[model samples]
Target: MAESPFAWIDEQARARRRAGLVRTLRPRPADTPLLDLASNDYLGLARHPEITEAAARAARVWGGGATGSRLVTGSTELHAELERELAEFCGFESALVFSSGYAANLAAVTALAPHGSLIVSDAGNHASLIDGCRLARGATQVVAHADPEAVRKALGTHSGPAVVVSDTVFSVDGDAAPLTGLAGVCRESGAGLVVDDAHGLGVLGEGGRGAPHAAGLAGAADVVATVTLSKSFGSQGGAVLGPARVIEHLVNAARTFIFDTGLAPAAAGAALAALRLLRREPERAARARAVATELHTRLTAEGLEAVRPDAAVVSVRAPSPEQAVRWAADCREAGLAVGCFRPPSVPDGISRLRLTARADLTGGQIDRAVRVISEARR
Candidate 1:
């Protein structure tokens, strides 16, 4: 005869159910017959033999986990090698690897935006960047999505140290940010530009250098980039790429980097293998982009409202949240796996079926996926 301490959580769950916003997890098996368009494996390297083999080799050579923080006993030869190669490949002066992309974002944002600084962030930035802005000591001003003029205005209002943050390619709509324009504005205002290329690496630029490289902003003294190894490299870690001084600053000041353990050796080795593979086969990047364009063209031709993809993600509008969930289920039933986006996930409150184009997806697979999606549309 005692009231539950978590009674409020039950009420919130009931509210979510009534609003059709309740979410649940569905674990996937190692091998499935369904065609996948839901995962972020844009380069289709997650299951590559070389990548996996490297991971296993690393685990054997360097043990399972990082024993301590990077400053303590966590740094390893593999991490150093990955950082050096990643920086060189991405055209940066230096790079620092982190345990995860979220932590990398946090480190970059918090380390760069010191106290009394101003942080101008894009309205449509990823959650990690948003959380970074929230945790940073600087004041945050969210500008319109992909708007350089708004960023300029925001920077103009501030007189001291300022940094503009955004995603290179938005994950939700798959639209690219105006990197050149944002960079120009930042230069004009003497502000630093920080971009999260989580969705751009291995899907844009020559040989998948990234959106910043594509925009000619790579290695700029005032520019910084954060990338995830999990999506494109089929590994599990994140890195911050910028000038050596900035990286050094992060090593000293970024709590996420200084206090957190170094990236696992397995992830570092896998990412290194994937990066070398990408360098050898540069066409993979172009292939992924081509697949995205093809998916968008075919989806629109089939009369579905799909956004024009700038990278490997293709988003198709859905009528409602419930309908979106049902439509995704229907696609699964048809032997296709797709992503479903709804209310809180989509800033605009529009539901969607989000499809990720992979470099390894064949034309036949594309056709089949399109057909399944078309038939499953509500």
Candidate 2:
């Protein structure tokens, strides 16, 4: 009998099962009676009629896909419009859109940190940023989470071209990074700063201009930011915002941008519509933050351990992975959908129930969600 090359997969699966870390996907219906707190639609605009209509109209005009890689044939007028508006909104000198947020991060980090360069990354950065560092030709040193002093010390060790990479708001714990402190360290060391504001885009800053803008680092010569359109924009895509020269560099040198297909027209259109809507209704940003605060306050008041949310994410501590999974299931059964985070996803290896606060959620919805979470806790 021939040896099975796939036999190891079964062993790994068994180990995962024994450790209560098995993951399964559940398909959600388009219309459900459940109150959703698991999705990243912070502004609750994913299903907005205007946004959907924009998507439909774009597909009708652009014919579905982008047709090719950006440089080859994919750059359409809509994409150009999106890039311009996005840059203006975020206060960036220029911007380049990618197929996804992960791709954007990879392009920015790998392109910026070339050979002989030093990349100082925060310990709590998203996996995309970590992978970017791994793929880059530069030497990478991961510092303490949100510790500007650690970054400064690391930068001091290298005299070559350096860049500090971090997330504006950590997704796992929902705590915001000290952007001002990090920016200061980068400036003192003469290193560029790259921040992933995926979580902060539509939830932080004045009118959701973003964390970098709020930190007064927007349009700075040495600052670059990556954001996802999937979250608050209720669309599908990502972009890099920075100086025009850096944007040109990414276009020329970033493998992810050059090799990957362009963003879909529908996504670009929907994102643009969402951005315009957000501009008109800036109060949506504040409402999301308020909802998160309310959820945290109510959860903690119920004697549950929850991290104080800095954006629209609220993370509540769970006793174990199994308990966390069960708790999330219980909440779903109670007509409330929440997110469950476990071992590999959580940097600290602690399990948690992650809930998102949507701007459209009503007072009754918030009260009901908190009650369900409390009752679901083991």
Candidate 3:
């Protein structure tokens, strides 16, 4: 047998093992009992009967898949309705749905800024946004994480059309970006602002309208946002919300939007149901924020280096990547499922335990989660 060109993968795998960075998937049983904090379901709607029913009903009515690209045959009435409600709820003039939030980010970045244009991205942006910057036709400058002055300086260096991209809430540290400051800088420079509100959609603003709306930038001519339906919406897919012109431009120019199939009807239905429920019971947003704050307070009080949460995510730092892996494993062994984030995923190369706070968590659950995490730390 001849050695393949991909033989270096074996060496890479060994290196990963030595660094305790080997990744694997574990299939969870439907009814397995474990305290879960790893998933991005920041709200309880994923399991809600209404949401599930909506998904099932949508699948039954719209069929299993979207059939083809949206322009061809993928668009469903359900998708339109979802987009309409989502736009109105988020206070945007228009919204365009995609297969996932990652796709939405790519569509926004790649489409909005063309050749000779500039894209000033935050250093701590999500991978999707980073990839979008890479794929975009515009030249990209990565500014310091959450530093509005850095953003201003980046924009000042260029005189042409520019767009500023950032995550409303950074994923690794669970710290929030200075949205208001960024918006002000963009406004002053006459640059467009594009926010990926994946973490903020279900935890910020009035009933989770999102970080941009909370910052009073929603529907602003120079502002845009992308959201994930899978997070607080407890569904699947993503959407880009902005002025009508921007969305129209996406429809015509964004390859990710035009080439990718439309979001599934089931996901659209579920997200719509979740949005309506959130509208009816707006306290869910506040509840999720409270849970994150409580988790941060308790963990920090125990002498753990936990970042102060600005939304529903609370991150506790580990000494090293190996320690982070071991700590998460220990927590899982103790009947608690937690998220472990390490190098490459973390731009700062700091490993940590990432936990998402859900709106539906009860007081007892919060205490249990905190105790389990604290006990596993040391």
Candidate 4:
């Protein structure tokens, strides 16, 4: 008999099961009764009537898909409009939209860090950024998490074009990067700074202008930022915001942008609508942050160890991976949905119950969520 080529997968599966790291997906229903704290809809705009109507209107007018890569036949007038508005809102000189945030990061890093250059990446950066560094032609050196001094030291050793990459707010622990410090070091070293604001787009800065803007790096010649529309915008896409020259470079050299299909029209429309709505209701940004603070305060008051959130994410430390999974299940049983983070997802190898704070959540909802989480803790 021929050898079983796929036999290793079973062994890996068994190991994962023994380690309590097995992952499974649960499809959500259209009308779920459970209160949601697992989603990234920080501003509660995903289901807003106006946003949905915009999506519908876009689909009616632009059809279902972009139909080609951006340069080929997919660059619609709507895309250009969204790009202009996004750049303006984020305080960047220009912007380019991608199919997703991951693609945007890949495009930015790989395009910016060419051969003989250096990429000083923070240890706690998102996987997308890490992958971008890996894919880029430059030499990459990862420094301590949120440590500007480490980045400075690394940049000092490289006598070439260099860029420092980090997340504005780390997703795992919900802690913010030292953006001001990092930016200062980058300026001193004559290095460009690239930040991923996936968690900061609608939860940080004045009126959610974003972390880079809040750090006064927005529209800076050497600063570039990437953001996801899926989170606060309640849509599906990503974009790179930077100087017009950088945007032009990516348009010409970024493989992801050049090769990948353009963002869907509905997502573009929905994101534009959300951006306009956010501009009108800037208070939504502060509300999301307040909700996160409240969640952290209440959880810690109940003796649950939670990292203080800088944005809308609240992470509660769990004793173990098994306990974390069981706790999340228990919370689900109690009609509250929360996120569970384990080994591979958490850089520190610590398990956690990740909770998201939505601007639309009421006081009663917050109280109930805290109670349920407390009851579910082992």
- Which segments of model 1 are wrong by more than 4 Å? none
Candidate 1 collision pairs: none
lDDT of 1: 0.95
Specify the poorest-scoring 10-residue window by lDDT in model 4: 369-378
Task: Write candidate 2's Cα lDDT for 1-378 as tens digits.
Answer: 987999989999999999899999798888999999999999999999999999999999998999999999889999999999999999999999999999999999999999999999999899999999999999999999999999999999999999999999999989999999999999998999999999999888889999998899999999999999999999999999999999999999999999998999999999999999999999999999999999999999999999999899999999999999999999999999999999898989999999999999999999899899988784
Q: Which segments of model 3 are wrong by more than 4 Å?
A: none
lDDT tens readout by residue for model 3, 44-154: 788899999999999999998998888889999998999999999999999999999999999999998899999999999999999999999899999888899999999
Q: For residues 321-374, write the lDDT of model 1, one tens digit per residue.
A: 889989999999999999999988888899999999999999999999999999
RMSD of each: 0.9, 0.7, 0.9, 0.8
C-alpha lDDT of all candidate models, in order: 0.95, 0.96, 0.92, 0.96
Ordered list by lDDT, greatest first: 4, 2, 1, 3
The global Cα lDDT (0 to 1) of model 3 is: 0.92
Q: Which lDDT tens digits does candidate 4 get at residues 1-378?
A: 987999889999999999999999799999999999999999999999999999999999998999999999888999999999999999999999999999999999999999999999998889999999999999999999999999989999999999999999999989999999999999998999999999999889889999998889899999999999999999999999999999999999999999999999999999999999999999999999999999999999999999999999999999999999999999999999999999998888999999999999999999999999998884
